[model samples]
Target: MNTYRLQQLLYEETDIEKIQKKKHNFIIDLPKYSFNYQNGLLTLNDTSFFKKNEYLFINKHNRYAACPKHCYQFIELNYMFSGKCTEKINGEKIDLKKGDILFLNAGSKHAISSLGKNDILITFLIKEKNIKVDLLSQTKGFLNISMENITPFFTDIFRDKQYHVFRNNEPLSFEQTLNNIIYEYYFPQIYSAEIIKCNLLKFFLLTARRSEKSCPDSQLEPHNSILLSQITEEINKNFKSLTLAVIAQKLNYNKNYISNFIKNQTGKTFTELINIRRVAEANKLIKHTNYSIAQISELVGFSSKTYFYSEYKKHFDHLPSHDRQYSAAEFLKV
Candidate 1:
């Protein structure tokens, strides 16, 4: 079916939604998990809802149906395809408009207000295992920490099970990617699964890039903001040989001052950021190219294979070979 047909399909209310309208309550069978939401129990949607071997589930949120407070067993991404919807996540109310996107991690307690018939919200449930930290490692505000230390960062953001809403400043590419995924999902063909995966990766990469670049210079001190812009551009372009000393000389700042400024802003030492950049680039090559591990290490500016392996493992918690094996499996999977 085409996308227009899919839209027509989504506009039609389901039997469950019809029943819900009569009862004025969402009556879906949900796990009885005890959660304190305004001193009430919150339902849990466990992994049992997913079939075995399924990594992703996509559907349109019911129109004119108010979903009850519930938490999920998997991560979720929601796109406000049209119109608007209001949702309360962990006590915070969020209003999402057309082209906006919302990301909710597993265990985020949320309740959706009733949606209008014109509202079209697309929901995607992704198994937690499907997320690759390497992709998000480049996100701003995520300090360049080793894999061992990254857990603490995750804990900070996810401890509250917070949800993030990103307004679609530029919607063409974002909406096109979402449309492509929905098309492949509703109209499956040979290699559709792989296409969905590729589109999902692109979706995440675009999100990361948007988040990284969305930070306005007005948010930072004027001098520091300009310095940060220059420093990041330098590192992104020349991470191979870029050092705090080299950056300091290029920017005409004291080496110690540059080091301290980087640490203060990102909570990561200058060396850690460079290594993280190198490892992130190497991971991209490992996943997308036929370069050998040794060649990738050298290409990313790691002088010694041993040191490269050490840094890569620290960031990914696995040898580069693991990524190669995983890529091979994905390629050969039916």
Candidate 2:
């Protein structure tokens, strides 16, 4: 699709927006807000616009609409197609420019400021079950920095009830990938589901690359950056057999010093980091392999089955066996 067609598709007003506009009183020019709330917050339980069997829904933000404090049961990704917008995610105010992407994990509390007529924000709502898990592996090396700066949307370990913002530095390639997703989802045809998945994967990779490019090394001290990078490489490669002592011996640093540094830098202890990696790997195995829960837990370096189960449930909110079956069922249904 050409740029004009894409713009036309996104800019076309929706029925709800039209009704919202008609309800506006120009005399006072007050901001439009949704009072659909429970317990002082607007928590959406389902995709109001999604059709049956539709897991992905896309739409433009209503112009001049100011959403009140709210959260959703599914992932929400917003792209600043034009103009600018501001939002408060978990009490942090963020200013988003054109070509920016904001990923709000499920259950993250946030509120958006009113958008002007020129601001064009496109949002994609994806059910939690439909979000791909393999994206965690992509955040291993240089892209790991992306996680620290902009965070990730697809991992159970890092989905800490937070919203991540990424600037699309390479707009040409990144926007094209996003546009492909919009086109496929908006005008679905034969195999559109598969096509949209491919586009979404590409879009995520582009977001990772953009995050890497946009994140400046100056954010972290020079030595801290190098050490963090090395530490992450070791953890990613050796988490299956890794320990604080083992990592310290390999890096030729005092175990206590390395442990303290890791905790201070990442806000996670050495053991916590290892457990995060192990549980993430176990999740991947549960989705892709036939290994039993015990075997998968053992393979990821957990010694006690009970401990592994606890950690897995803590991160994923599901038992390993149940998650495997549920994942399979979700795959077949999709």
Candidate 3:
């Protein structure tokens, strides 16, 4: 295409999408990348044909391409600011919408697809040194932490720290908070390595916390939340073979207290809450993939298909087959 024609094509395409339709090969060689921040538009740098530049990844593709399979040196994160991207990672497939945060950890192989225009993403290719110490320290704020001893590596990254998120809109005040970090706070000193390390760690913490707003332990009642968390952990690890009696005995509480506790905190009786989660997983498998109804039934902790289906319909108001066949958006209509 001629330059004029290409420029004209580009001009006609406003808010173009940044994604591909085909899967990209996962490549190793992930590195720390950075972009120049200017008016909500960050530039993507190119590091290798298979890999993008250090600090950030910026690409605009309508077709699917192989991503560099998971590498050892870096971790990848992408926040969809607009449009959507269907991703296939290792073996799991996920559809990312605006406001979603996707993480590709070290050694995690993945690929992606583009939907249409307005499908922009803000990405971070975090370096290993940044991931090991700095990111952990900042994100510890999200969890219950009591760090007494400061590691030398952590001390360096903490010299100046700030956090940022992509794809979600915030009030002017919050946006200004983001601005202060990007421009004012560490301000890219001669120790660019330290400055970059700090901001990236901050971003990791901010993004991780944003996704965990419904923290079980941070609920209205701390004690109740802690109990619920233990219950949840038990169910998660053994939801398939779960028994209310077993959980009640394990917590040294009467069955009635356990039942009432779950009801008061989660607004669902013990059995009902269990079914809620079991059925929720069933719904995801049903719509997002081609798992057979019977298969999904087992996967979600149902030992008996009949019982699973019965409980599923009771809570979801639809047969598992019908609900699973449709995406969450479509299921709501029914």
Candidate 4:
């Protein structure tokens, strides 16, 4: 990710909370942000990697804000290999210079201006996911993360002005880490992305294990995992009748026990878990189809209009009619 994109992700995530940076060698603070379209390059040519053509934005931009510039899509990390700018990350503003690396989470937006003409930057484009399995071996299933995850993890700390070094040739540990990552991961062609992927799994496993965002309870036991998978299948097949009691009857577990088990093992109630899928499908229909809110509501199994509105608002913080217009930038703020 370049400085431009880093500014964008920051501009987006600033809505929820300020993400800080972690400490490294030479410099104490590194400021970064995310971008809009930084990851499109992975396609166009390489057929061997990331098969899915769709890129998911971790950020949702502020289309209505009067901003100097905007990010499109992509997780970007901006290493101020050397430069200066008055930057905005998800609307949060900062002054940045040399010896700083700014992280931008996916889909976040930001703006930047006022810079040295000689400013040079290094970028890392990545995707973040809780690591699905182990890198070296799958002996123990643990939650891991991608570099895409770190760009957001250390965002706030990098913004600390006390850590910036005005000097051009810097002796910062972050620089070294970046150098090591680039040289070690990108240079050697033998299993390059795989090695980086593996190391990324390790790095996240070491630090993110304790993160509040990590869903520990969702890690299913072998038997229960299979059962839950089956339950998920049934829910999709029969969302209209996929109640806790009905699901338990078919699976041979008591209704109350099944409800408690689902929450304990998945950290989501039966209704919440099922609604996640339903809402996802509804969102797609709202964005891609010409169906009215009422039509879409009925299609998604909401028999009552008021209940559908309430549920939709609870999930997206916007009405169904409101989000049906993402294609309309001017309509977003309405």
lDDT of each: 0.75, 0.73, 0.52, 0.51
Cα lDDT tens digits, model 4, 126-231, are 4333233223243234545334354325443233221112222333235534543455443456675555555554543432432323333345568877887888
Tens-digit lDDT string for candidate 3 (1-334): 1334423442233221222332233222324463233332223333432232234333323323334222323455565645677776534467777666565554344455634445655454555453455445644756453222222222322221111123344421122222323332223446544554455545545544543453333555777767888998988777667888999999899998888888777656777667767877787788887778999898888889999878876654457766654565685687
Please give the lDDT score at residue 230 for candidate 1: 91
- For 1-334, candidate 2 gives per-residue lDDT tens digits of 5678778877776666666567641111223342246655676666364566556788777766677777777888888988999988755688988888888887777777777767888888887553443333334553444332333346632344466777655533566778788887778789877777767666766655555554444368888899999999999999999888988998899999999999877778998888989999999999988888889988999999999988886665457887798889988998
Q: Candidate 1, residues 101-195: lDDT per residue as tens digits?
A: 88887766678888877888999887755344533433436545332232221233343236666787674358878878898988889998777
**Pairs that collide, model 2:** none
Superposed Cα deviation of residue 258, candidate 1 (Å): 23
Error of 3 at 119 (Å): 2.1
Top-TM-score structure, candidate number: 1
Better of 2 and 4 by lDDT: 2
Off by over 4 Å in 4: 1-105, 108-205, 208-219, 327-334
Residue 270 in model 3: lDDT: 75
Clash pairs, candidate 1, are none
Task: Give the TM-score comparing model 1 with the true structure, all chains together.
Answer: 0.55
Question: Scored by Cα lDDT, where does model 1 land?
Answer: 0.75
